[model samples]
Target: MLGRLFLKLEFKKVDYAELYLWLGSLMKNNCKQRRQFLVMAAGLLAASVVPAWAAGVSGEVKALEGVAWRNDQPLKLGDPIMLGDHLRTGADSKLVVRLGGDVYLLRANGSLQLENKGLVLGSLRLLSGALLAVFAKSNKQIITPTVTAGIRGTGLYVEASEQSTYFCLCYGEVELMPMHQRSQQFRFKANHHKAHTLDAKGGVEKSPLRNHNDDELAILEALAGRKPHALVG
Candidate 1:
């Protein structure tokens, strides 16, 4: 009877050990499943957050001495910008601005009024002085300017003075019309430049001229707020 009782006790111990091992395996599998579920949930959350951060204007503006206005507030470098602000450069002051995706170089005593929200849109009014516009290929808009020249998907040099507006196409096509007569359109190709003069009856006269490298120099000067010869090589 004693031997039988001892054998029974050993059998019970063996059964308990097997049961404990089985429970341990089940717990480990459950923990692994929970870990994998948490990892997938974190990945999904990160994917949803990426697009929310990339939908605003990403550009810069440098003021030599004047002030730029955006959303009825003064604009500065590293400041977030919105649409419908007037950018005015004071006399002898220069501005380098990037809107949407285009780079604009405004020379001394120049002003550009923004019309749309993106990098390029609506109308830009060149009150005076010069502006060089370099547009990205993805931008497609009819940039109309009063007393200035317009370029589409290309780089061009625009200079406005008291006399008239001069436009030289450095790399792409340009459209010109008198500020008063928006109906008439004139297209100028690359390697060509033209000047438009307004007459008494709101008529426009065009004169062709030789292209010069002065436009690039003017752009560099405007961006650096000094003479081009001093900065450019």
Candidate 2:
């Protein structure tokens, strides 16, 4: 079993630090659990490796539950996620993907479109759904019907609809611009979660953090072979 797992993991590569972290977390487990951890680590290691790409494929699905579609075709774990693809999740579904060093989680009943400039994700258009993501330090944007957010190396969560959008800058910095009122745009930095809502009329309002947490950010960062701020120490 361990050999098979290793062979499977050979498809990708992970950082040694990630391996050590995983080991530390599971060191207290029983023998069988330890084996299970090895298997899971093998998979994670595979995901961290940059595979030889097919044209336009810049990433792959790391975790998937229930049903998902990529460009209207059935999506599966380990499948390459290409640039400019449309991704959707069915009821009760969840999808996690890694691109470069970034990680994203899409919740049930969500639709998102990837916009890439070269190999980097330039923007994410949340057509209608909920998404949580952690990005490596870079300039990027998140777009919704009601708002567009310019972000720099941040962990973020958003839920979008035609009438309103909920946004949480989980960490780092953001410049938020409401669709109907770019004149009212504002910028802020967040050491922790900071929440807001944008309405169709180009209004921005303070909102309470909801539907996301630091633990989820940690999970996403781990999948990308990095640590969240809270776990850095």
Look at candidate 2 and tell me the lDDT of residue 186.
82
Global lDDT scores for all candidate models: 0.49, 0.78
Model 2 per-residue lDDT tens digits across residues 1-233: 44554454556444333343344455555667665554455346435655324334588887777899999999976788878999999999888888776788999999999998886679999999999999888899999999999987889999999999999988899999999898888897898888988899987789999987665676676566664454554
For model 2 the local lDDT of residue 104 reads: 88
Runs in model 1 lying further than 4 Å from the true structure: 1-55, 62-74, 117-120, 138-150, 161-163, 192-233
Clashing pairs in 1: 99-119, 100-119
Model 1 Cα lDDT, one tens digit per residue, 88-158: 66565555665654556676656666677354465566656677666655433333343334555566666
Per-model TM-score versus the true fold: 0.53, 0.78
